[model samples]
Target: MLSPNTTLKQIEILGYLGTKFPNWIGDDSFNNIVDIKLSGSQHCSNLPPLGQLPSLKILHISSFDSVTTVGAEFYGNSSAKKKPFSSLEILIFKNCHYFEALSMSDGQCQELTYLSIYCCRSFVSFPNGGLIAPKLSDLNIYNCPELMWLPEKMTSLSSLKSLTIRSCPLIKAIPEGGLPISLSKLRINYHQLLRIKWNWQTLPNLKNTLSEEGFPTSLSSLSISGCPLLKKIYDTKDSENKEYWRKISHIPHVGGSSERQEEDSFLNMKQAMF
Candidate 1:
């Protein structure tokens, strides 16, 4: 539906409209619509099968309060074998308060390049195993208090280059396996709880050494804020901690800050010690 009724909340509306609208892309219909923005509708139990639209390139959804989980219903056909949203490049979700999980299918969203999630407090998990998105290059997440863990298999996102996480208090560590070696730019702020807990062990002061364990070998840019303890482990003037500094010394840019900002993308994120 090119002109969406802002008041409509029924998931059936799109399917009904599909027959009336004939926009073709590849083997799918309703392909002419490149952008869809849905906001303030809270009654839908699941995200509509927007994934079936092969030509959709940008999707923005906000304030759909009743959608507690993102699962097979979001991906039409429920077949991992068939690529969904074959041409989508940007996907954004904001203020989805009750959103809890997202179950992505294999090869779905393969062409996506940017993804952002904002203020989804109850959101909990992403796809359990790697739902590969080879073209994804940027991912930004903010204020999702319960969504902590990054995908454990970063390698699955082979093209990921920039990552931003701000104000997510519960995420305690990077992906369990480690930051994907492919990550080039990283910005983190207000993950005070997480910065103090990246170490595999939960014990106190047992060496929360990310560089030694599995921080990426290289990054073009790095910024960290509101993580004093983490800064301590890496930024050291003490002779005993020279090794730690030496480990990350090769990075060309390093910045740190104590403040949080409304915008968390690369442009607004200033230099901070990372």
Candidate 2:
């Protein structure tokens, strides 16, 4: 019943707030809300109905444990076909255990630029269609041990610039051809990843390669740590192929005293090398 251009720009819905959402949210009232914080609630089963928000840019959902699923219908009816937040640029979900996966509706989140998920242990895989966000530049996944692999079509992120994955023990390898060619910074840590394979030729200006192995050419800065099995930097075959990766700045291992110290040392070495 509420119209789109309401004066409110930011809203925080807390305890017992779930039942009142559909009525509280205006059709375009949320368009100006760039930041929203939801906490201490239940019953937010799906996002607000579609076409309700045309300008929402950032959304954060935290500490809501009762939500189990999110689907396309939650955004809008099949016939109306509205996107909940077309201008949304940053989305963060934290401490949400019941949420298993998120499948974006068609033509949703076209301007989304960043996504961060933390402590959602039940998540197994990302949504289908690779959830492309043409302006998306950063992704961070942390403490989701159940996540097995990244979306296979991840290279569709043409504007992605930074990616960080930490404490995801089940992930075995980076998705083949998944890394975007426009990527400039990548950091992966605490995953059970055993191999690092990438199309080095596609990433000609990659300035940093931080992992156990498979660094490409033009890697002016490199760091390898937390990998006890990696005794050598490069295989004998690749070592002979010197056209790529003319110099490596730092190489450290987990056998050292502490991870924090080792990472610091690696950074120091990188600074010196550059």
Candidate 3:
């Protein structure tokens, strides 16, 4: 097998390259590559078996119109002894309209820390249980309308610190286990779950009754928007809502839709959280 140049650490394949990758593209030939970016290739129908790249730490796939599912083939041969994506830290997928599922072998992506999925309108699900990343600290999902639920056992992610979900209207609530205690920042916008009431059914009119299971005390910042019901509680006067204020008084920053900012500023602030 021909190998990449020994000095190569990063490889980027733009759309201009061709309709598909060569046969040797995702094999051990790239054993030393640390990063790979595949983007703007609308004609490509499938992804290469990138999980076999032993040293890969970052992978970015975007703008591929034909890839409908990311499954076992993308992860490589199950017979291989080495675990899939064992060294990966950052994974990103963007603008893949038809992509629907991301199925992975259980307990894969053990080293992942940052993950972001953007503008994948047709994307529907993660693995049956959830993504298993013990070290993952940041996760951002944006504009994925068909997604139904978050990863299962979210409370087990002891290292997760920042989570932002926006424009994913179908997601009804947080995972069943609730968020991990390690989370410090959270932002939810444009969701459709009014019945769950942001995990606090009585929070709106009640006094000093914050749900510990819903929002962790370790949180330093919380931002919410696009839910009319939540907007009511935050609008209360300080004197009348003393108990409500007291519940979240310890948090350093709490934002609501009332705070106005330019679109660029909003996007920049979200990026800085990770």
lDDT agreement with native, every candidate: 0.64, 0.64, 0.74
Predicted structure 2, TM vs. truth:
0.73
Question: What are the per-residue Cα lDDT tens digits for candidate 3 across 187-252?
Answer: 777344333445433222211344443554545666667766543454343345445555655555
* True-structure lDDT of candidate 1: 0.64
Off by over 4 Å in 3: 1-4, 190-195, 198-218, 227-251, 254-274
Better of 2 and 3 by lDDT: 3
lDDT of 3 at 119: 94
Q: What does candidate 3 score in Cα RMSD to the true structure?
A: 6.3
Q: Candidate 1: lDDT of 93? A: 85
lDDT of 1 by residue, 123-150 (tens): 8888888547889899888889887687
TM-score of 3: 0.76
Clashing pairs in 3: none
Q: Root-mean-square deviation of each candidate, in angstroms?
A: 8.4, 6.7, 6.3
Every model's TM-score: 0.66, 0.73, 0.76
Model 2 scores a C-alpha lDDT of: 0.64
lDDT of 1 at 117: 87
